[model samples]
Target: MLQASFGSQHPSSDARKVADWALRSHDNRQAAFIIIDKRAARLYVLDEAGRLRGSTSVLLGAAHGDDTVPGIGQRAISEVRPGERTTPAGRFLAERGHNGRGEDVVWVDYDAGVSIHRVLTSNPGERRLARLASPVLADKRISYGCINVPVAFYETYIRPMFARQPAMVYVLPEVKSVDEVFAMAASPQR
Candidate 1:
């Protein structure tokens, strides 16, 4: 494992680059931050000091786009089409919140109904848990828009870190350049 910033082992270059940039820029403002690498289907949780708190495989949107469909969040789940389901890529100030079922979640994009919560096993057909364990990247893409993480990871790392405070969540884009998504790329170096 390649040792990156703050003792984190990042297997993907995109994830490492984003984490390094965020720390170098103080973009997180000393708050804990999360980097969700879409290509790798991995989630890295870091503390305020850029220390890796935990890492895990996660489930993302079924589609392979970076922008959310207009008014998709406002639409009922049954009304959302497959193509419209996307997890917009960018930096999000996420906070602890509850979903419709009163389950706690880290609200990534509240208006877009994009949040990071425990994996949903309600549908046996989805095979969310199995997909998470699968080696194929395609198997991981099976969520409406929200991010699904393991239950233990949620309780051990995510819940405790954001239970009382909001944090930054940088979701790497699969279709757009990082510079296009993050304005910090255009700013002068510190």
Candidate 2:
């Protein structure tokens, strides 16, 4: 069996609960796994054995919710209505790739145009870096649906996490309980 260890500082209360269950489960244990806590605006990267590899703040969708809007990915960021933006909460077999912009990223839910990549600096007006460095999670919610992360953090942690294989990404729900999103992954025998 794989061993486990905690690497990041204490996670949010809700994150702790879901992580507790994830720790007990074995389904996603053989591969690198990531836990995106939208409510806390944090992402925790864990190793194949469930040991915490790294953790960093992340920028999520502008709207607060657990589901992604259908067809939102086809439209321009300006065309998407406010509520349509969401970093859907669920499991994803995320893989690495180069976006149309030629930037390397890990697509969490490609159909929804949701991917985790370095903070977008193309639009300085977005003030993405400032938002990510802010002392509050509220300011971090500015993306359409993608999870924006610091370049250093993305390179140092995220990229390496999925370097060898496709990692499982678990985006914890903000609108729903952890039990709801991770019900199947959380087996009692775990």
| Candidate 2 residue-wise lDDT, 43-138, digit = tens | 888776677888888999999999988887787778998888899998788999888799889999988899999999888998989999897979
Each candidate: what lDDT? 0.86, 0.82
Estimate the overall C-alpha local distance difference test score of candidate 2: 0.82
The 10 consecutive residues of candidate 2 with the worst lDDT sum are 181-190
Model 1, 34-99: lDDT tens per residue? 999898898998877777878899999999999998788898899989987787898888899999
Alpha-carbon TM-score of each model against the true structure: 0.92, 0.88
TM-score of 2: 0.88
TM-score of 1: 0.92
